[model samples]
Target chain A: MHDTTDQHLFERVLQDNDQLADENRHHFDDMGAYVVNFMSAPGAGKTTLILELAKRLKDKLSVSVIEGDMVGDLDAERLRTAGVSAFQISTGRSCHLDAAMIARLLHATPHPEGQMIIIENVGNLVCPAEFPLGEHLRIVLLSVTEGDDKPIKYPVIFHNCDAVVLTKTDLIDHVDFNFETVEKTVKALNPKVELFKVSTKNGDGLDEFLAWLEARHSITLTASAV
Target chain B: MHEAAVALAILKRAVAAAEASAQKEEKAYAETAENTAPIFDVVKIVVQVGEFRNIDAESLEFTFSALRKEFPRTQNTELELINIKAIALCSLQNHQFHPEPANYFSCTICGGGIQNLISGKELDIVNIEIEQCLTETAA
Candidate 1:
């Protein structure tokens, strides 16, 4: 029996301290809060959706946002104007926002009472999906302009996401985006994932989306009450 | 994309281990001239990486090369990446582990569902096979 040294090496590697982000996740859980990690490709309307969700839910629920980008605080600035507490996390040259980054952002922006924090991860489908920010929900947004085959091309992101929010439905008529194909593919990848088709411009289907969110919040509250 | 960060973490750990091993060997060599041998020779480092980990092997290789240049002792070490296939273990029913590579794995018992990241999510230094250098006196 060639005592395979590989297994010993693997165990040693696993023992390495690679979880600097786990602490932040513990803090988030302690707050009895829900964090939504929003991911998508560049210009997929993540910021716009955050703005809309903030405005609609701010009065009803305590809402804050941790906006991530390669540089600049533009998204955080925009979120601030929308009347939601916003904190910007510029990744410098990093492509994705990891749990460590979110943990730092949390220190900069303390958890607010009765509010759920939304982490708008840097717009990249691949890298963002790899790191978990201890979010209760992972929402991957796809706009009509990005095409329908996106789910197929990036199945990992779709598969890991708790829900898929299809943005820019207002331009569905302008583009040849097929809802059927997108829905079918997403379902095939993840049957239990909640799907929402929304148009921020026209406010179409937003109410239903909000209702779904309210139900989720209510469930959280009930669980916490016990 | 984020492989650089992962690579950095792995490199730091490897360096620490190498340094510790090297120091122990150096102490033993000082005690006896016959025990004097080059701590280890350059060979290969095998690492198991999970598919879901999203580690770019090429990028990691590049980063390692650059980092190794800074640490003269670790130069010329080859990084052999082994991708581990992920198996989804559903938290729903009795924490059952599923070996199937599917889009998602659900637990039938608790309904607690999570993407089973089975194998590919690894960043480890599997083994370093170093050639034991013979002392000048022995030769």
Candidate 2:
């Protein structure tokens, strides 16, 4: 091996990732499905919110979930129990799932026919935000337990997201979460991002969230039909 | 941190360039002894680290130093980091926004508040400077 030829190695690394990104986009388009990459910190209620959404929209919309975690198939199991088709992706030592990983996972699992696919990214407010998985929309979750300053602290995730979900809203009374402050911070990061405040246990504001999903699905269907 | 990864990438590039320059100089030195001259004294690598990228300058420097040690050709080279500030443009407010000091604003038109993060979130190697040795003129 030539010692000075190491420069080509750098180009190869970047090129490999770029190719993976392209393949992911192609798969997403070929399936004629809209993918939503769900990102948030730990205990942000991503799984619970997804289960709730699946329960509500499963009959009307074909829903599938791709659960990502360092280990354990608990999230996929939870979705299956909720009557939603699910696949688990255990990343092992990886902090964030890249497009290459997702592309391989999609190949292993059967694609949902003309359905909406949700990828629950590893519970990270940072690294996952930097890598794009060819998802149509990026949704970020912030629970009441996390504090109102989360949007300000993890601004990159908030800024890149198409929508922000305030989960575990039922605990607002128990926790010191200031809705006004959180809203102010979120709006400051993304002026046009759709905001949804939801509670899976109490069934509060869930209808609005479901309506938003249906509206987005309808738009995608219409656009694809044309 | 991701910046450490980025710095490693930069260091590899710099070392590669230095090796190439050294090779060219060696070739010239063999062909004409009179033209034997130093290719460059030092190489300056300018990188822009942005706040949005969440890269720690100190961590990047440390990582770069460690990686540079592996490249003997770039042992004497210097790594220069130039941070590029980040700015956010709020569609609601129709204004250029900055985040230093961390200020948030509310839009008057739609009553929607906006936060304009102005600094941090940049990761790039903007340019590099190389020093060339001068040749002596014969009288």
Candidate that would win on DockQ: 1
Global Cα lDDT for candidate 2: 0.72
- The C-alpha stretches of model 2 lying farther than 4 A from their native spots are A1-19, A109-114, B1-45, B63-79, B90-93, B105-121, B128-139
TM-score of chain A of each: 0.90, 0.89
Q: Kindly report the docking quality category of candidate 1.
A: acceptable
lDDT of 2 by residue, A58-175 (tens): 7777888989898999999988987888888898876677787888877774744447888999998977876778787889999999998888778778878889999998888899
Where is the poorest 10-residue window by lDDT in model 2 chain A? Answer: A1-10
What's the fnat for candidate 1, on a 0 to 1 scale? 0.28
Each prediction's TM-score against the native? 0.79, 0.76
Model 2, B1-139: lDDT tens digits are: 4545456667676765665666666666656757554344335676766666656678778877777677655555567666666665556665555543256444434444445555555555655544454433222
What fraction of the reference interface contacts is present in each model, in order?
0.28, 0.17
- For model 1, residues A31-119, the per-residue Cα lDDT tens digits are 76777889999999999988998899977888878888999999988887767788888899999887777766566536343458888
Best TM-score among the predictions, by candidate number: 1
| DockQ of predicted candidate 1 | 0.25
Look at candidate 1 and tell me the lDDT of residue A192: 80
